[model samples]
Target chain A: MDEFSFINSIKQSTYKQSTLLKGVGDDAAVFRQSSKDIVTAVDTFVEGIHFSRKTMDPFHIGNRALAANISDMAAMGASPVFYLVSIVIPSHWTEDELSQIYRGMQSLAKQYKIDLIGGDTVSGNELTISITVIGYAACGKARYRSTAVEGDIVFVTGTLGDSIAGYHILMNPGQFINKNYYYRRHQMPDPRVAFALELEDLQRVALNDISDGIANEAAEIAEASGVSITINYQQIPTSDSFSQFTVNQQRNWPLFGGEDFELLGAVPKRDWPLVQQAAQRTQTMVTEIGYVDIGKELVYLQEENGRKPLNKKGYTHFKQVKL
Target chain B: MDEFSFINSIKQSTYKQSTLLKGVGDDAAVFRQSSKDIVTAVDTFVEGIHFSRKTMDPFHIGNRALAANISDMAAMGASPVFYLVSIVIPSHWTEDELSQIYRGMQSLAKQYKIDLIGGDTVSGNELTISITVIGYAACGKARYRSTAVEGDIVFVTGTLGDSIAGYHILMNPGQFINKNYYYRRHQMPDPRVAFALELEDLQRVALNDISDGIANEAAEIAEASGVSITINYQQIPTSDSFSQFTVNQQRNWPLFGGEDFELLGAVPKRDWPLVQQAAQRTQTMVTEIGYVDIGKELVYLQEENGRKPLNKKGYTHFKQVKL
Candidate 1:
């Protein structure tokens, strides 16, 4: 079928939802909710820039892209209602392969109960995915980073650096012989959507997803909240493979890798017990990695030595791959 | 400065807006609007895919991408409030060039009264610009395209086929020796922002942006509405040069050329007078290109012949570039 016919077929499949006043075939999709609308987030994932075609398959790429934005919605302690997705795939990709990408997206949308209300598809030189997720909350309770006061406990959901190991295995299979851990991390990232929603009324101080590793994200919250962060190295969560590859694996990979897709959140010192209880209720493991301090810096509180300053460089697009 | 520092500097410069509970630095930017909230639109302009690196500057490309999404908000009669722009530029690109691109975006954002809330910068193979424009409307009266009836008259805002002509000249300068209309149309086609806002409360039956040419866009609306449409050849508006290029341009180029970015709307017959008056008041001309018919086909009504069915092929990313 022609592009128009293909688009038409897709449009016909869209089921009407109560919140969505309009869907595809309009300038913007309209929504008709009764209460105060709250938080929204947009994230774009480009093939070569965000993920390598050599390292990631179309399905994982699609899932990760959608997951990245969904994680953002989760971070805000809002229930994701609807989303718009725009895909720009290079002409070289087959329609069947593209359909698989959509299949992956459909899986996540179904899982999260977030309706895929509208989107755009176009041909381009490289594959690019952009998704905007709209989530609703009560008037003023959406979570943010700036609310992290000094003495707030820093917490993270899920293990980090798995994606980093996964990337290494995906990109340089020969160099890193074993494929299991790295591949798993690269393929599937569990966005802490359930945990985020559960903590909606728990008075969590600040929240953010760990897209660009824990250390970089820590620095971000520190800067935004104008508070210092001192991360206790022993408290940082690590997988078995991550621990095994200690010297060669770059222990800081979890602190700097860009595609972990985990959630890093902060809770007031007084509410740490409540935060811990919420994590158990959501059936997700939580790690207390650090604490907010008075000075505006990110410091690594090493077990052997005293505290030291940290750099802001994360997984850089250019440094990882040379043109 | 490094990429992190640059981003931090930009973040530091941002003034806190009370409407935004959280801006940047977190998993997502949170907004706390009074009555209603909506996640808006995002458009990506990648080098070589959306524009020729040789012809279009990064600045214009950035501005245009933002404008495209802003135009979508206007189509829904929503005021653009915030935007997140993620840019991926090659390592070779200077910081000055990057700043210039942001300068273009900043100027337009300021003019539109939109805060450049947050975005990410990364190194990549080619320049990529993606912008998500967040906007809001007062819940009830946002326009949509699924409401068009059989008796509605179709109207289009601004001119068409200019981008195709502009592309022709830009790609092959020798072909179009004279510059005036060709260059301006190629560089910048004004998005009808004000006109769309004026369309509020009109119960605009169906609406779409004419990014793709009118023929293709009309077909989309008709196919979506399950109605037929016929365009009067004499009533179609074109600039002097558009008419001049008819001999050189084929039916495909005029009908299928995308990037017009005008608004194509279907209005009830009774609202036609009001629409025309609104257009006149705004000092912009509105052309009644066609009317909704009973069957499901796009027939171009020609004076010489009773009716000629037109092909619905518009600009396709996969299609071979003609120029």
Candidate 2:
């Protein structure tokens, strides 16, 4: 199909939101924001830098792109409502592959009830997808990275470091046992949107999505809020398969193996019970891994040996730069 | 500079909009929408596909990217407000070039009183910049291409053909007599946001920003609204330098050479006076180029000899595909 016909077939189904007056067939998409703050973020994934065709299909690439941006909205304590994708296609990309990419995004968007509002498509030398996610939060209630306060309990939802372990198994096939488990973990990240939304009623909370690894995200919170953090290594939750990996993998992957799409949050002690209740209601695994304290801005891991500063830089082989 | 520090120096000044609760240092930018419908669009510019470093510099490239999106908002009869830029940089680009590119966007954002919210930056094989612009219009007032009605007076603000004329001169240097006029027309587009916003109170109006040339844009309106359009060739406006171009240039450039960033609107004959007053107040030159009629969906241009079908596809030298 030509580009216009392709656009006509782009939408998977009619959207349910009455606020979305216009979708794909206009100069711009129109949506009414009824008394809420809009939270939006953009994420880009390039072919060679972020992924290769050998490990991920076109569907997964699109899924991964949209998943990352939606996770950003979840991190801000907002209910994701709409998304736009701006993609750069190489000359060789087939329409079928393009369709698979969109299908991947639509499938994930369906889970969150998010509308695929509009986007831009262009031809270039490599496949690059940038997704912009817009969500709504109650007035002045969206969480921020710089809002972590002293005495806040630092916690995370879901297991940490699975994506990195999955990454290792996928990159070097036949090197690890139980392939499907790791494959799903790396390929299809379940964004922690429901868990993040559950905590919206809490009075004091700070959240950051784990696109970067746990250690790096903690450091960001520390740096942004001017608070010290200490994550107890033993308290960090992991899967049963984590024991089968090498010690180096166990030590570093959970800390630096990014793309986890989990929520790392900090909440005051009075709000901790509410956070825990929300996690339970959402069926998410919650673990109290650390605490915020008054000190110089720094993040430390409380390992068996002693307290050691967490490396702010995560795994660098795949990601070169991000902001 | 590294990406993070570059982000620190990004803002020209702290944003003035109180509705923007949070700006750059969060998981997402948060803003309160005061009962207005949100209008948003995404536009991407890729190296070689859109423009090369030879024809346009980094600043002009950034300016062009944002201008295109802003014009999309204007086309929908919305006021341009906030913009986010996601850029992919090649390894060879200098920090100075990247900064200049941002300087271009910041300068334009300043002019429109728009805020620089947030974006993603990454590395790739070639430079790619995708911008998402968000604007607001009164509830249910956002216009669409599908709204042109029969008997509406079709109009356009400003001259149509300068960008294509400028593109030729810039590509083949010293061939044209007036260099600056054409150069500025191609490099710097004055988005018709002011004139578009001026028609806010009009009872019935339809608009489209002139990005895909007058012919293609009108065809879109014609096809979307299921109306026939007839544009008088003599009625199309042009600059003084236009008279010096070749007959073929004169014939095609005005209809096919896009990126003028002017507003093409359709309004009821009764409301035409209000549109004219809006144009006069904004210092924009308005022209009655055509009329919308009930018929088979098609677009035509009437000339001295007779009426002819307008080519739907515009100039193909610079742009390959856009949606």
Give lDDT per model, in order. 0.70, 0.85
Candidate 2 per-residue lDDT, tens place, A1-323, comes to 76656776776459966678898878899998777888888888999878778778899988888888889988998988999988888868987898899888988988888898888778778899999899998887899889999999999999988887887887776656667887888888888888888887887688999988988899889999999999999998888778889999898888888889999989998888898899899999999999999988899899789998887775342134444
State the lDDT at B63 in candidate 1. 71
For every model in order, the fraction of real contacts preserved is: 0.30, 0.68
- lDDT string for model 2 (B1-323, tens) is 65556767775358866678888877889988877889988888888867777778899998888888899999988988888888988878887888889888887888998998878778788899999999999887898888889999999999988987888888777656678988888888899988888888987678888888899899889988999999999999988878788899897888888889888889999999999999999999999999999988789889899998777875332134344
Model 2 scores a TM of: 0.97
| Total colliding residue pairs, candidate 1 | 1
Per-residue lDDT, model 1, residue B209, is: 72
Predicted structure 2: lDDT: 0.85
Poorly placed runs, candidate 1 (over 4 Å) = A4-17, A33-37, A53-55, A167-182, A240-243, A247-250, A315-323, B8-19, B33-39, B138-140, B169-182, B240-256, B316-323
Could you give candidate 1's per-residue lDDT for residues A168-285 as a string of tens digits?
7677656554477668678767788788777767665688788777777788788778888888777878775565565646667777876777788778878878778888998988
* Docking verdict class for candidate 1: acceptable
- By DockQ, who's the top model here? 2
Q: Top lDDT: which candidate number?
A: 2
